[model samples]
Target: MAIDSDYTVNSGVTTGVIGMQDPLYLAPGDISGLNPVASPFNDKHYLKWSRAVKMALISMNKVGFITGKYPKPAEIAATYQDWIKADYNVMCWILHSMIPEISESLLYVQSSKQLWDEIKDRYNQANAPFLYQLRKDVMHTIQENNQSVVNYFGKLTSV
Candidate 1:
């Protein structure tokens, strides 16, 4: 029996037909050793690092891997191995974007989605104390006569 353009297995999984240009497509030239971002994540700049990584992944068409859109296929599926390869490549890109200590701690994470979720969970906490301190600093900030308006605003926002 021939499969249709979109096929569904008895397991209730619908597999879409992917082409060579699909984001899920793992090209021969896609390497795992390259770091997409210029700076490694140092744990302090979670917001900045995450935005940079997201842009890089978006350019490479691999953002879906972390967002859990391109999930792994069943082991018996024809595209299972291809999905695994792409996932591994994405995982490497994420690891390479982090400092050695942070990456090493996450080395055992099984999938890119899991790794991404873990990192988000750890660094995305809301610190009331830190926020209060920043608010206080902003309130107390005074523009010195020597400081330019641009520099004064920059300092306030940088906090």
Candidate 2:
């Protein structure tokens, strides 16, 4: 028996080998809004919006683009072009999930990871002013006469 690019036999057992391209292949439909987050991120909904975006990216197996797990390759590397294309797709998905004002400000970002970090730093910070605002809103809450007791309670808890 002769061995080519196929299988090899060792100790009377045959093993098969396979070559796979990178998992970052993008379909035509994947070029546009991936609908990662149903509502555009408006700086006020970081926690809820980020969770939805992450789940969408995970579903597409593209979370690595934003997480830095798939680092960019050198310009001369064979995979560099493919990596860049996939990175752009991930960036587009993220941008489309954001409001125009926010996305436009990040238009020139070179990598998805950089954009992700920028947004995370700007919105995910736990600052005192934000906490103060939340406390104020909670303290000033008033239930309208037309509102049901359960609904009024929900509004307070949501704050």
- How many clashing residue pairs appear in each of the predictions shown? 0, 0
Top TM-score hit: 1
Best by lDDT: 1
Give the true-structure RMSD of model 2: 7.8
lDDT (C-alpha, whole model) for all candidates? 0.82, 0.79
Off by over 4 Å in 2: 1-22, 133-159
Worst 10 residues of 2 by lDDT: 14-23
lDDT of 2 by residue, 18-80 (tens): 223233556667765565777899888688788898898887777888998888877854456
Candidate 1, residues 1-111: lDDT per residue as tens digits? Answer: 121323345577756566655666656776797787889998876887888889988888889889988777779776676678888999999999999999999999999
* Distance from true location, Cα of 90 in model 1, Å: 0.6
